[model samples]
Target: MPRSKRVTIADIARLAGVSPGAVSFALNGRPGVSEETRQRILAIADQHEWRPSSTARALVGSRAGVVGFAVNRPARTLGTEAFFTDLIAGVQSSLAQHRIGLQLVVVPDIGEEVDTYRRWRRSNQVDGVLMLDPRVDDPRPALLRSLALPGIVLGGSPSGPDDSATIWLDDAQAAHTVFDYLVGLGHRHIVYLSGPAEFEHVRLRSEVLAGLAERGVTGETIITDYSPTEVATTMRTLLSRQDRPTAIVFDNDVMAIAGLRVSQEMGVAVPTQLSLASFDDSVVTGLMHPSITCLTRDTFGFGEKAAEYLLDVIASEERLPDRTGPRPHLTVRESTAPPPA
Candidate 1:
């Protein structure tokens, strides 16, 4: 005999003598159904094993109750990094309270990540999105502003290009704090190893360090693609020079970890021969034989704030938070020290 047609909510509704709407309410655990009817419809759906489908969405213009979280992080960083793990956890915290779930997508690179957001909205894959790694003059805010779609940006500015209410972190302060912390540690010659040029946060960091360098301090800017072998190769070349940098600040902890390995391989003792710091304070840093010195912004906190802000925007489009004030603070660790005398 041929296999039975794939079960649908309508099938369950027919079997239970209930409306499709009632079936949906029961399946989704919505409040419209009475307890007794809810149990009966759920029992029938369980027997048939009915699941949601976009085809049903066309039948009724409503939500699939799934939200998109589209982030643009380097492929190397995403795989070697644990910062996102905590960030995702923070979002899950808020979502669990509402019984909602996230659909995560990490694109090949920043450009593809932005493009995916546009497609997700057009295809109706999600009701809204959580965008991270905003850049200066990013096109996404403007694109999303014109569409009926709603989302929260997880960076330094605008939740929506037209509106400012989505929660955003203070990147400038985070940058400045990291720079000053290095200077305070007596790092006279410093090199800032950053991620892609398109990332606004890294750009902000470069700009901040440039201003400091203008005052006759040693600050060099080198934005490199993150890779263990690449980072090691770069450090090998940089450290071989007679006038090598005394300290290096990386944009992410994973790269800093590479820097640490490079220093060890070159017989350059950390703190004694090289000092390092990085952003994205992951547990890997602490687990290192010597924990990393980093610009410790609360990624978990940022995630929690971004999720709530997105939910608020979805509820009602609101203004973005102010960017003129203090930014995320810096928490120093063991990875940094003054140049060896």
Candidate 2:
């Protein structure tokens, strides 16, 4: 004969000739069921090899056993960017220790990201969330609070006192390091090839560049979507000018490589004529022909810390204070040198 179907409380109740409530009480070791009924229910449950369902556990205010990470970036960009991959790996490493899972999603804009959070909460799909790339007036923090969701805002400063804990890096100090290094190298005319202007880090870096004007440095800003095609087009325009900048700093390594390729095509010798640097570092930065100079940080460690914080908040049901995260340090390579005399 074939094995019997797996038994639920209802099935066990029918087989034992008792009500479902009585079976539930017996199975759970609650008081209402007699010793005789409890023994029979246990035998039937064991015979059917019944196990608790995770979904059922969630509906009863128990953990869903997973956390969420939703990023508001173009899907194509995430495919090319190494920053997120490293960060996510760190998060997974920490989560693995606690036998937790991560659910990552990519959305086109903030609106969709907010909707995702709502859906996750309604279905009890995630225990908490991890937010990234905070904007100047970001609403996600408040939204997370409104939904009673525990979250950590990574790579950004706290927007409000009552908002979720923020894991912030000092963008201003990092930008100053790059700017002062270029100035020390005798590059008076510099250009900042930036990412979207709405990003708080981009705004902070631009502010740092603007302050250089007092020191008699000519700093210009050009914003892009961090796409190679747009970066190359902008690079071509910059290199075509007679008064081209002596050095250009990019927001990411991919953009730096795009600009470097454009410079080579335009017959501009790197370091000898124009110096190139980037804010984010990856293996490609070091493997490039001249090796782009960049800011290096432990992105993986950052992800791990974010995961740790969110999990702690979820477990304790308490709000944690904002924290300062690691800042990127300058890594000089062959791409940067004294401006052409």
Candidate 3:
């Protein structure tokens, strides 16, 4: 038997009892088609294994049909961070639905990250870019706006030109929740193992911790690179102090797990001699010997929504309102408890 002909948009339209234009709008995720009709058209296309050809996509004036994601972190550290892994998975899943690709790049610092965006824009390598690790005086947003590039800020407020949108988490509220939880557990002497101070989220968390000083809770902030080695060293230094904290909170799972190891090596029992909590929840937190209490959020869903918003910016000229996703919630586990007597 001969192979069947490839399915076309017209065939999809005919089968769905819609026009070719309606099928185009549905498949492209445009606003013209109703949600029910869009689903039906998508179902038919999926059944037929139909995909838009690169030629067709380009003919519609779509440049490159790819999105860019650049990060300013050590490659090794990024490799161990499950948060980014899950986030990228969500981003790819959403972009795949639109038949778009993701261009991922890792830079050593914010300067290089800015340059990466400039290069992507100059070369037309991506339809838009996703910005992460936003800072107080971030220049990338302005640069992207000056270039008239469509971009989305992943975890910070929209500070760029009107063309960009921001999908941010409520970091301040999350910090408050964690702080209140720790204080309620009788942990008065606390130390926050944090990421670099330049990050906006880090600053916000630090501020929240500082506010505890007024309430008679002694809170100390120690900045680290979120690397296991740095975190271990910081943990050991703080633990060796004459007035060591009864509880320590780490900014990420990698550092939390390392702190746990350092505590064990130094003969400090977790949740007995010292309590530990992590900011970001990951697989290692739950599977470790003493499950870590940490702040958990839908990182995957965050990525998906960010990608969807960026795609919308690419598809239209209207400015969309900035979106805020669900805030991170504290998930209690074995790692956190009342300080030892």
Model 1 lDDT, full chain set: 0.73
Report model 2's TM-score to 2 decimal places.
Answer: 0.82
| lDDT for model 3 | 0.83
TM-score of each: 0.76, 0.82, 0.80
Clash pairs detected, candidate 2:
none
Cα RMSD for predicted model 2: 11.9
RMSD in order of candidates = 10.3, 11.9, 13.9
lDDT by residue for model 1 over 1-341, one digit each (tens)?
A: 12367777677788889898887776665789898998788666545544456575677566646678876655455666777877888888987787767888777766676556555554356777887777666777676666566876666644443643446666667777777877877777889888778888887777888888765677888878766667788899999999999988887888899999888888888877788888767778878866787766667766776677677677764554533212455666777777787
Candidate 2 residue lDDT tens string, 118-234: 657644678899998878888888888777778888864554677678788888898999999999999999999999998888998998998999989999999999999999999
Give the better candidate number (1 or 2) by TM-score.
2
lDDT of each: 0.73, 0.85, 0.83
Number of clashing residue pairs in every model?
A: 4, 0, 0
Task: Give me the candidate number with maximum TM-score.
Answer: 2
lDDT measured at residue 5 in model 1 versus the true structure, 0 to 100: 72
Rank candidates by lDDT, best first.
2, 3, 1
